[model samples]
Target: MNIFSLEGKNAVITGGGSGIGLGIAKTFIEAGAKVLIIGRNEEKLREAKLSLGDNCSYKSFDVTNLDAIPDFVTETKSNLGNVDILINCAGTHLKKYAVDTTDSEFLQVLNVHLLSVFALTREFSKVMIKRQKGSIILISSMTAIMGMKQVVAYSTAKTAILGLMRSMVAELAVDNVRINAIAPGWIDTPMLHKATDNDLPRKTKILNRIPSGKFGMPEDIGYAALYLVADASKYVNGVFLPVDGGAAGGF
Candidate 1:
């Protein structure tokens, strides 16, 4: 057996119109999986699809719309087949001190990043369980591991996901469905640029923490996603792979 092959897989990636999500979609498709990406940006999705080639397509939907999840899952399964892999990569970032963070803002981020993730996973796991095999990838963050100020909402949501993954592991494993997470380090994306572009000191501090002394690219996470979902990692289940250039271990 080819350990790295995803040749007959069907992958669904959320937040896949741009950045890391798009990167995963592209890489997955290249690995011979048919990819259907979900996001709110139709134009960006179209552009992404064009670049990802014939095996790629996309759907436009706001994840916060909890009422639409069942239908979306049904439609996705119908359109894409059994959905061998599900990549939960959609989320928003809010930077604010714990005191300054509004109740509304915190809940909004949770609804998108945490709650919707649950809804989609619950819905998709139904099909995957019946098939007795599937890979579910959760996109976690560095904030989830290390404490960082001014991102209370984002941090709370991401940290909560670790709990979610652990709780579901034993149950999901019983049915042969694997759930894992990726905690990415400071990646060089427009969002990261926007976060630190004005603060050289902050950027420098972040870079210093990373032993590699450079930010990672989206494809870095993409390739990691492929390993988690592909044949190579069949025995791996519920592990959080931190693709952080050794940042997590820094002093």
Candidate 2:
């Protein structure tokens, strides 16, 4: 049997309605995993469900609603059976200088990108622990490792993910639950488009840094995620894998 096969696995992917999350969900379905995607936008989720067909489903919920995550996880487990994979892909990015960012703005980013992730993972780990088999993949960013301007809150939240991934792996490995992170560099997602809209100079500067000489596609991250979530990566834990097209190596 192929170690990459996920024929009977059930994956719960947050933010799976669009962008990198959507890409990862699609890849998992193609690899024979049943995927449940959660996002705040009903329309996007509906579209994703349509595109993904019977093996994929969606739930409309804001991940930042930390108080409700345990209930959400419980309901998901009941509805979908055991969730063998948990992908924390929902995040918010506020592009503002540290000096200009308000407290609420910073907290809001942290709420979605960090706090909610921690809460959801904590809840899901119980289910995984009982099974003694699972994979948890967190979507981090290149900004987590490098200093980037006008994204103070986003960078901080992303950096926190590394620590979270490492700590979780340490505690969860005993239970046979693997935890890891992906730090993507400048993927061409809706968020990236929004960040680079009408800023040709900045866009050009970014493109020039990538050794691949092009921005990464969501599918690129998707394939990388597939490897991590599948049994192919059973021995890989607590590692921050960079799918950045050599951007990390360049700078």
| TM values, all candidates | 0.98, 0.98
TM-score of 2: 0.98
State candidate 1's TM-score: 0.98
Candidate 2 Cα errors over 4 Å, as ranges: none
**Candidate 2 lDDT over residue span 93-167, tens digit each:** 687889999999999999999999999999999999999999999989989878988999988999999999888
Can you write out model 1's per-residue Cα lDDT over 36-149, one digit (the tens) per residue? Answer: 999998999999999999999899999889999999999998888888999999978787789998899999999988999988988899999999999999988999989998
Highest lDDT, which number?
A: 2
For candidate 2, the 10 contiguous residues with the lowest summed lDDT are: 90-99
Find the candidate with the highest TM-score and give its number: 2
